[model samples]
Target: MARITTPLTNTEVKQAKARDKEYNLSDGEGLQLRIKPNGSKLWLLNYSRPYTKKRVNLGFGKYPDISLADARKLRAEARTLLAKNIDPMEHRDSISNHQKEKIENTLLNVAKKWFQVKKSAVTPNYAEDIWRSLELHVFPYIGKRPISEITAPIAIKTIAPIAEKGSLETVKRINQRLNEIMNFAVNTGLIHSNPLTGIKAAFEKPKKQNMPTIKPDELPDFMRALSIASIKIVTRYLIEWQLHTIARPSEAAGAKWSEIDFENNLWNIPADRMKKKTSSFRTVN
Candidate 1:
């Protein structure tokens, strides 16, 4: 016949003194209170694997942090796993891994991961703008939610307030970014379909407005002002070049002397430099 271990009380556990050597106070069924020489009390479970029959020690936690009742509950759950022929530590690890994966698949997490890959292709200022928009508009509502849980309605709701504020352009841009993120999730196997696809149609279309520009009649005065203004010579020349060639400010700024075909009276803007690749050259004359 095997000797049975007696159950311990909370009072005995609390008052248990530490000695030169570490010792355990049994609470029956493998749960024990380990008292260390430094007076630290820890909860531990000693159990044998059902398959291999090898003994294992499972840490419940420190005694005060994990109350007696909680330790017993954990021990009972561990025993339940043992009865099912599963290792308790392995089961705990599986549950932890699942939770970690869930956190990693959250809308914000997935969006950030996608942003890391995208930021390299865009300017630093544009990348900062992308994150700023998300932090202000998208993160408050659905960022923490798992990507798989995001629905079309939720996505619409997230941007509806911005649309209602007459920021239709912002709404459109946010929707575009969300579409990219959701598409990334799909490609990565995190989701089956993009919930934000076609979501832009739900918002009001932005009104088109032409950029402010000087009228043809104002050109003489504009040129007079430019020539006399307290501006650098290079800047004045750049302005004159843009006005004559009708080139965008960016194209004019990036123009190299080598691309200027002075012999032919032509500014041969490279295909790569032209906004529309088809338009290759402009007659400077």
Candidate 2:
């Protein structure tokens, strides 16, 4: 028959004097109050591994620091793990490691990592714009949060104030940059999903405004003013080309001789050069 030890009480533990040697007063079911020779009281739990039957002692902290009730709650949690054949110590270590990883993988850290890759692909000025926007708008609220824990509501809330300020265009650009950053996180396995996905629906849709242009009668005066203006010959030609071809300023500026076919009277603007990808050709007549 197994030796049965009497369960210890808080009063009994308090009244019991510490001896010259360290001894544990049993609270039954693997929980004990260990009294040391120096009079310090510590809570400990002794349990066996389900697989190897190896006995292990797990500390539940100091007696006064962790009350009797708290110690029992911790012991119960440990026993629950034991029943499932899981080692409580190892489970606790895993949780600790996960929290540490989360702290290290903050949104700012991941965004910086993603920015390093992105900066190389864009011009320095554009990269500066992206960083400035993130620092001004996104960082204040959620930058320190774990990337994996940033949900759609968090992302929406971060940008809502900017949208509400009637900076709809700025909001759109920031949203695009955030989406790209989150996508990079997903692709790199830092996060499982992009929280900024479909985030545009949260904001009011921006109304489209057509580019301001001069009337047909006003164009001759505009051209006459351009001819007399002390501008470079190339600038004069660029203005003429824009007026005649209705090409955007960027398209007109970036035109090369190779793209023009004199025989066909056509300018083959590549998809990359055009504002829209499908607009590949323009009549040059």
Candidate 3:
């Protein structure tokens, strides 16, 4: 006849102390609390591997952390796996690896990878602004989640708060930026398809508001105000230069004396300074 192993009580587990060497307190069929001389208690489940006759021990966790109740729950799960011809250790190991992969491939991690290539196409200051926007508005919400899990619903929920605050334009820009990041993930094989494709449809389309241009009637007041404005003289000159040359603030500010043709009355700007980077010659008064 086979000897029967009795189940251990929670009191026995708590009162048990480490001795001269390692000792085990068995809780029935397979669960055991192994106490070491170093004052450590570990939960182990001794079981026979399915198919093979050899036995092995599967570690649950340390005592107090795993607790007696938790150890028994794990032991019962291991027995269920054994009944189905699966190795408990291997199954647990597989789940652990998947979780590790998800942590490694989070949204913020993939965004950094995308930004490395994207930064080369833009100015350093613009790149910094782009990253700052992500850190402020997006990262706190879903950046830690895996890139593969960024579905449209989750994305819509994230930016909805911004939209509610009457920043629809900001929300639109964020959507476009996020779409680019997700596309990069797809191209790099991080995800199969871009789940953010239809996310824009989930929100209201931003209404078009044209840039505030001075009307003909308002030109006199504008010039009169500019003449007495509190701004610096150099700033006044640059604004007038921008008005005349029909150039953006950045383009007008970048003008150099070398680009001026005194004889021809032409401002020969460099292609690099222009927004379109093609038109270089402009007639200036």
For candidate 2, the 10 contiguous residues with the lowest summed lDDT are: 271-280
- Report lDDT (Cα) of residue 221, candidate 3: 94
lDDT of 1 by residue, 79-108 (tens): 899888999988888989878877889999
Reference-based TM-score of each model: 0.67, 0.67, 0.67
Local distance difference test, each candidate: 0.88, 0.87, 0.88
- Cα error of candidate 2 at position 101, Å: 3.2
How many clashes does each candidate structure show, in the order listed? 0, 0, 0
Looking at model 2, residue 263 earns an lDDT score of 98
Task: Supply the global lDDT for candidate 2.
Answer: 0.87
Instruction: Give the true-structure RMSD of model 2.
Output: 7.3
Model 1 quality (TM-score): 0.67
| Model 3 weakest 10-residue run by lDDT | 270-279
RMSD (Å) per prediction: 5.2, 7.3, 5.0
TM-score, predicted candidate 3 vs. hidden true structure: 0.67
Deviation of model 2 at 269, angstroms: 24
